[model samples]
Target: MAAPSPTDHKNRKLLGRLSLPESRFIADALRAETVGGVLLLVAAIAALLWANIPAISDSYASVRSFHIGPASLGLDLSLQHWAADGLLAVFFFVAGIELKRELVAGDLRDPRAAALPVIAALCGMAAPALVYALVNVAGDGSMDGWAVPTATDIAFALAVLAVIGTSLPSALRAFLLTLAVVDDLFAILIIAVFFTSEIDFLALGGALVGLALFWFLLRRGVRGWYIYVPLALAVWGLMYNSGVHATIAGVAMGLMLRCTRREGERTSPGEHIEHLVRPVSAGLAVPLFALFSAGVSLSDEAIAQVFTRPETLGVVLGLVVGKAVGIFGGTWLAARFTKAELNEDLAWPDVLAVATLAGIGFTVSLLIGELAFAGDATLADEVKAAVLFGSLIAAVIACVLLKLRDRRYRALTEAEERDEDRDGIPDIYEEGNPEYHLRMAKIYEDRAAEHRRRAQKAAAAALQSAAGSTTEADRPA
Candidate 1:
């Protein structure tokens, strides 16, 4: 190339330093959340319209109540029940895989980083529950639905953020995601403990045995769908018969899968399965469940009754007001007590707006509603209305708050670009003069020291592992 031009050589150097592209699997999963949220919304709307219109309400009811499974195995259930108890298991399975990945190698793998979201999730769940309980005090069975507002729907909340929070800091999204994951774990626990009626240990034992086999197969690198599918279905059936919310089986299987990559393995089985299953869960399972569960009769009488009931009011208020207060309050308290500072790129206002977005508890809230009022169709309808209404209100308020924050963030970015000296320091920070530059220099030095320490630790670990492997290789084998 004729002793490459100076500009061309510089471009080649810069290109060499660039990072590799991100895995497409992860990008697709994130994008699927937004698409799934829209599809879920559409399904809920379609169900509502079908249930409300006088011409098709009866037909909608007929289709929902229709049964078609084998009764000999206690598997015969209404279409709605199948959607809730069966299809939802797929969604939970993907959630379980994601949870395992997070616990193993993701943000939650670090204790200090995980603590903020764990505390926030616990507080987020508790506040909504307490608000529901306080509202339903002295009521007969209304207190049974206390867990209704305790969930934060990850896909729905993320969709809202994706739509209106383009300018928000990445840290805010990370906080929200971690908080929601923890909340889902708690919600699963609630379902297993509170919602389950009569547990048959024999069936549960069978499910456990099947799960053990599934785990063994997975660890051995047995990736055949035919082998795993039958085992999974058997486990689901046994759990369903055991009355432990068949979905728990999915969670159990997900958590049991080996997350670490073997020496010769291209990817961990957890990641492989998650990549394959997440699309089905997001596109089909969740929307199907929503279509069935969200078909509440939105009549004038139903609307009046929904507002009149303490249970409905409790759910609405708990989700709207309680989620915001709990998440924000918990974050503040954690940072205060632990002496951990918030990210410099984010503000308290951004955290508050994120907390509001946490209130959009759609998927799990609806599931809890169905469980809370299993036999009583009238009460179930009321709970559905409350969930829809509350989530909608939360979405609107979150959009407004995020839009304002987006404007402020854009202004901040513009101000930072106004730096004249090209010293890489924002004008606002530069106003403090020499002391600011000295502090910046100290920060750079500290960061460099930390990087060196990490590199040394990693090298030592690799050396030790290699030595151990060499010793084993030289042994009897």
Candidate 2:
């Protein structure tokens, strides 16, 4: 077999180990996403219930249809429009920040590290879109909804992973996160390109100028919500009036933020801003969007139409089958052609499980459904039911697969913890021997103590020098 070259070894392992800092960041992000996912699920349930109940369904529809906001600026919109346009902008802003950070500093910064997920994300998107298009090819005017199934709801997917994949390798989580992030970026692009009606160049120019000012101020180290909030609103409104999706404005602003930290800084301005805004996006903005957007009548007729309507059926099939096939197949093809190999800790089944989990296309799917069928309320409602149904089916199936994998991993972990040597500690921890760690720990501790002592001595010498200089000056030199 022509003695395997060192290059072969180097090329091995797709979704390879992450750096400690990157791992920590992923962990923190997953935690936040898990919470957000729960809130999203709750909000979705509330919406469905509110819309379906016989007594208050009318009230639910009326409330969502209620219009408020100043009309002069073209800001007057229904509650649902506000949720989809205004609030979802916050969600997209957070996504944009995440995408920016990933490209600038996270795993996606390295082409080698990024190649697999990027490919998977693109394929994942293409597959569902293809599936949707194929199903709706015969149906007149149904092609517009192809993008509806292309998105994977990161929050919902991560939430499911958190609940069921507790023992799965971190590489799986990292892969899913990166894949979803890329998926979100593409979804935004599709919205920008396909869903736009007509451009009011004047409004678009004003939005561009506002974005430039915002970027310029940040570059100049200008800060303060008081200064930026109104600017952001103006940009959003202008973008809305410009006939482009207003959420794009949020993304533009987020991308313009500096993602790398400066010297002596704990976090970059982008990170700080994300930290401040993420909770709002997750807890309020997304949940509210879901509450407004996911409220479809799940009557027998609506549920039946999800299967019978060509566009709705395409959405369901595209999300449920196409997502899994695309992500898993794309990953396999990439690994086969490229030098990359799957991580040893993960098997094909694990990949399949993650791929299935990616099929939970809830939030963004609902948003796109609304956009795609803006003039047809009935068709849009059917698409909503289709998204909910497809996502639910995907989640249930993924849960089963993940639970089995998690159990296997738990068993393996327990086996590794066995005290084979009859020692007080587990075999895995003691494999490297505690004595070696103790020595290393001692060396680092001594080095830290030495560094502190030097700092103190340097401070004392500086004080003495200052005191001598003052004394000399007082002597009338």
Candidate 3:
């Protein structure tokens, strides 16, 4: 075999080390998602207990089935539908904003940096659907649920990482985030394309007009929650009535938002909106959706059906086996064929662990399962059980692998900290010498000087305005 060139070596590495800002951002995002994941888990558990405990199970069903909203506009839907169709739109909206930010400004802006994750995400999704389809075909079952195992729930995956991979490289988290973001985009496309039953052209046209108005107002710098809220509600309603999944409206609006900040602005409009709405989505919307959607009856028969039913069985195997193989194999193939290589800090084992973690497809998987078997309530419940069981198995396996990796990394870090050179300084602190500190100090000093100049300029302008006002008053007297 020929030796790889330096440029090839540089370009080929997967999960390369992240920049400080990017690392910090990932950490913050992981923390937030960890909380959301916990909430989702709690809600799912509560729902299961409520639905299976004979005394309260009927009430749970009744609450989930109760209808609400206006009937005149075809807006009346059961509480479960509201959680699935309405609140999930908020979750997808946040997802769309993150996707936009990443594509426009984050690591995804560079095609080279994006290629690996993009390929992995594509393969990750494809493999699951393929697995599901093959299983269903062999068993003579329906193919509608092929997409059920295709999604990777970011909240659950990140939460698992946060808990088990503290000493692992930040690059792993970045890779997972990028992969999940691309996964979300593909999932949205799938829902919008395959799930629609019919199109109400007029209503769809009205929705498009509303979206255009939204873009126009945002571009024109029109600001006010009152105006945009009503407009957004109208757009969502029109979209729902158009025979399209209403969540598409949220994704559309999120993509349209400006992701870059203007001069003097601390954050972009998309960032600000995500910050404001993320809490609502995480704390309320998603948990409520889980509460309503995850209330599957876990009877002994239901449990057996999850394994025996071809469609449901496909969901289980797809998530537990297919996701791991697809992601790991895709990344390896990309590196083997292309100039890219595995990141020096990460090993094939780490990638495998992360890939396994990706199999916890909780939220979107459930949504697709419901959509796939909408008419067969029994089948849908069985599918839900399968998803829960599969995700649990995947989570446990990932947790074990990640914990092992974390221990190794922790030991490596400790070893690095203990080793010292002849100069009596630890090798780990060599890069943090006085020279590096001096350079950082210089940078801070220059920023401080620039801030002082701006402050003086503003003060001078204020003083000049006050003098002009005094002169005008004196002259008038």
Candidate 3 global CA lDDT score:
0.85
Note the Cα lDDT for every prediction shown. 0.79, 0.85, 0.85
Q: Model 3 off-target regions past 4 Å?
A: 1-12, 162-167, 411-434, 437-477
Give per-residue lDDT, candidate 2, residue 233. Answer: 95
**Which digits, one per residue and each the tens of the lDDT, describe model 1 over residues 1-477?**
001011211222100111111112233345677788777778888998988899999998999999989998889999998998899999889888778876876556656656678989999999999998988884443787899999998788766766664544334555666687789899999999999989899998998899889988877767789999999999999999998999999999889876666688777778777778877988899988988889887778877876678999889888999999999999889878976665555578788888888999989999999999988878988998998888888888888888877877676546544555556545454665887777667877888999999999999999999999999999995
Tens-digit lDDT string for candidate 3 (52-159):
999999999999999999999899999999999899999999998888888777777777777788999999999989999999999999999999999999888766
Those runs of model 1 whose alpha carbons end farther than 4 Å from true positions after fitting are 1-28, 138-141, 162-167, 263-266, 409-477
Q: Cα miss at 120, model 3 (Å)?
A: 0.4
For residue 32, give model 1's deviation from the true position in Å. 2.2
| Local accuracy of candidate 2 as per-residue lDDT tens digits, 1-477 | 011011122454876655435645776788888899989988999999999999999999999999999999898999999999999999999899889888888767767767789989999999999999988886544787899999999898876666665654556777898898999999999899999989999999999999999999998999899999999999999999999999999999889888887788778888889889999999999999999989899988888889988899999989999999999999998999996767776688888988998999998999999999999999998998999999999999988888877777676546544554554444444546777567557777988999999999999999999999999989954
Candidate 2, which segments miss by more than 4 Å at Cα? 1-12, 138-141, 162-167, 410-436, 439-477
TM-score per candidate, in order? 0.80, 0.85, 0.85
Clashes of 3: 3
lDDT of 1: 0.79
